[model samples]
Target: MTDAVDPPAERLLHDLGITEPGEIDVEVIACAVGAVVRYRRLGVGDARIVGLGDRAIITVDNRASRVRQRFSVAHELGHWHHHRGRRLICHGAADQQVGVAGCEREADGYAADLLMPRFMLEPLVAGVPMSFDLVYQTAAAFGVSAMAAALRLADVHPAAFALVVEEADGRRWFRRSASLNPRWFVRSAASGVSVTADRYGLSRANATFAAPAQRWFLGQGAKDAQAFQTIDVMVCGRAIHLIVVA
Candidate 1:
């Protein structure tokens, strides 16, 4: 998302003089915003927030990874800021997808903004090309999942690319940069034979290759596809491709 989208999160960072990624202490920030963060084994959701007036308590799942815990805290903080006076239980990132409720998406956006504000993330990805290395690096630096970093990078990075996640069952979804042509719909894993599918489980040292636009695109975009390339890498047994316009 753009820097202008959420003013409260950005304003909070500004008020606290938080200019660096490591400075974003979600617990501390939550406390500053009248919320107390707690950790426990949550059986129902990743996190939950209960608010009374200005003060609130955020409970996160302790069994989750540190990055996940951080995101849960930030997400509850989002609900605390936007949906105060109401109790909420969030399942996880899957609930943050497009078709979910507006409130959930809003909270997700808030969490993203709070965790990886554009002001901080932009500079990190300023001139870097999108790749698994860049995504993993950003994830490490920001204490977020590679998926989150990839989506955020696609949002702020000045490149026309897409981060595609293909499941073992061949299901797929993607997040594309704004500069990517609107017509460039990614081809489904089952619809066509692709080098990416064939190259999985291989070393990533020379994974980057020039492939025909038709190899990745479909319909109008495929017909008018520009010179493009892909960097396919196996991330946690899932096929991840960084499709970049060449």
Candidate 2:
């Protein structure tokens, strides 16, 4: 019996010689799907598909400096190949994308899995040194953006991880996985709400500090069942740290 989920998208990624980061083939994917592949400084795109009824339109905005349009194009093509006939529009920085669960998130996962397969990420993450420059270089090696690399590392790497992005003005959106067991009780004294990455990582940072040390947590079923860890990272630039605890 056929599995409920489609495996062709992933299978094509591997078969197309894109089993690593830098090996994305935007042109090929564009040709295959009859989509137009172009580069622009248009702010954001992690594979956005304009799924008009009759045919699907795919476009990848290469505006961001961190990741290449190649991966973006491939990412869009992921939606085209697997999610054809469905209108999928992905906006914002790959890191700051809105909503936690649903098609957008699923497509993002699919994009990462396709562009930076576990096979390549495992060995690469295991062997490579961790640093901003080195990390950027690795992302370059994979032909993906730095943020994209960080996202993948957070998933497969055993170390505790957190990705912080700083835009022109301040902190944007940041997500910490289970490995990053942040302290949950430390609610903001002012707002009384749980502090998120955008609150500190980008929004508030400015002239003074280069790096900040803070803690956050991921809550489980019960209030007490929260995971916590301390994240020490840079104030600006895209920072991904291998935290101490898991």
Best by lDDT: 1
Residue runs of model 2 more than 4 Å from their true location after superposition: 1-9, 17-22, 39-57, 61-68, 88-101, 127-134, 164-173, 177-242
- TM-scores of the models, in the given order? 0.85, 0.60
Best model per TM-score: 1
> Residue-wise lDDT of candidate 1 within 80-114, one digit each (tens)?
88888765555754423434577788888888888
User: Where does model 1 exceed 4 Å of error?
Assistant: 1-6, 93-101, 168-170, 194-199, 202-206, 219-238
lDDT tens digits by residue: candidate 2, 87-126: 5456622442434456556656767766666666667667
Candidate 2 similarity to native, TM-score: 0.60
